[model samples]
Target: MSERPGLDIKLPNGRHIQYRGIRYHGSPQHIFWFEFLPTLLDHTIREELKKTAELAKSTSVSVEQSVAEVVALLNNLVQRAYIRAVDVDRSLMGDGFTKGEARDVAHNVEGYNKYIVEQSNVYVLEYSSNEEKVNYAIVQEDVLDIKPNFCGIGININALWRKIKGKFLP
Candidate 1:
């Protein structure tokens, strides 16, 4: 009689949930955790934008004005990411590029951040699943790294809060 190969599976209870000669519970959830890090960063940016807009509004600023201000703030937040330089078309000229144009470029920051987070979440979910099909250990490690990055983004957002408070208060 031929001997079957041993399987290695991870259970939800922090134990190896094994299946027919393989790990069954080792799904993309492990990988999804790592992918969650960037999504969290994007979420922090969104929260900062919203908070800044709220502060602007409370100070008697119009919604449009607040949006513009938030956009500028967001530009600073992700300066390292070079998001604005990459996505914004500085070459475009005309009414759209005017200083007081209704469609201010800064106002698009929130939308851009939202789109990035949504797309990243979708991709992470799919990628995690694929990783599970291959190897769960890799995905788990990736998620562990993301946790620290997410925390860093949160700290950045906190600093943004302080700046907004200082700017609008008194």
Candidate 2:
């Protein structure tokens, strides 16, 4: 199969991103734009593990042996919206060709790559040599802000860093 060309677009955040296979569709296209998420999650998880391991090393927590458990925790964080995508969809729809040139009713048009972002609670986790604690905070989006909807302290820090790192690993 040939690789589909992606549409380069900017997120609400200042950072720009690309969505593969976003083309004008006469019908509808179901593209999982976030397919690059797993690899992203992997790198993010490893980094978080290293940090936690270092902290544990200082406190005798032995989190180095808890890779599996930490991984599970990370997965849960993602599922719980610690890490999430920002909402944005672009679409242009109309019936193929209207009978009347000047005035005519258009056909129904819907669907594209849908992105769901959790904009509420942002969770934060800190594992210092002294302590490990998870906390959260709520934030409202600024209407005029083009910056992407981001996860907050209420969200997972690892997840937030993944986005900030901005590498889409395939």
Question: Candidate 1 at 162: error in angstroms?
Answer: 41
Q: Could you give candidate 2's per-residue lDDT for residues 1-170 as a string of tens digits?
A: 98777666543334455556644343222222333333344445556666655666566763424443555566465553311321122222334443212211111000111111110011112332223231121122222333344564255455565577777653
> Residue 24 CA error for candidate 1 (Å)?
22
Pairs in steric clash, model 1: 7-21, 7-22, 8-23, 9-17, 9-23, 11-17, 34-143
Judged by lDDT against the true structure, how good is candidate 2? Answer: 0.38
39-148 in candidate 1: lDDT tens per residue? 54466665655565456446754434445555555545654333433332232222355422122334345555665445433333333334332463443343323222
CA deviation > 4 Å runs, candidate 1: 1-34, 79-170
lDDT of each: 0.44, 0.38
TM-score of each: 0.28, 0.30
- Residue 94 accuracy (lDDT) in model 1: 25
Candidate 1 backbone clash number = 7
Off by over 4 Å in 2: 1-21, 24-35, 64-69, 81-170
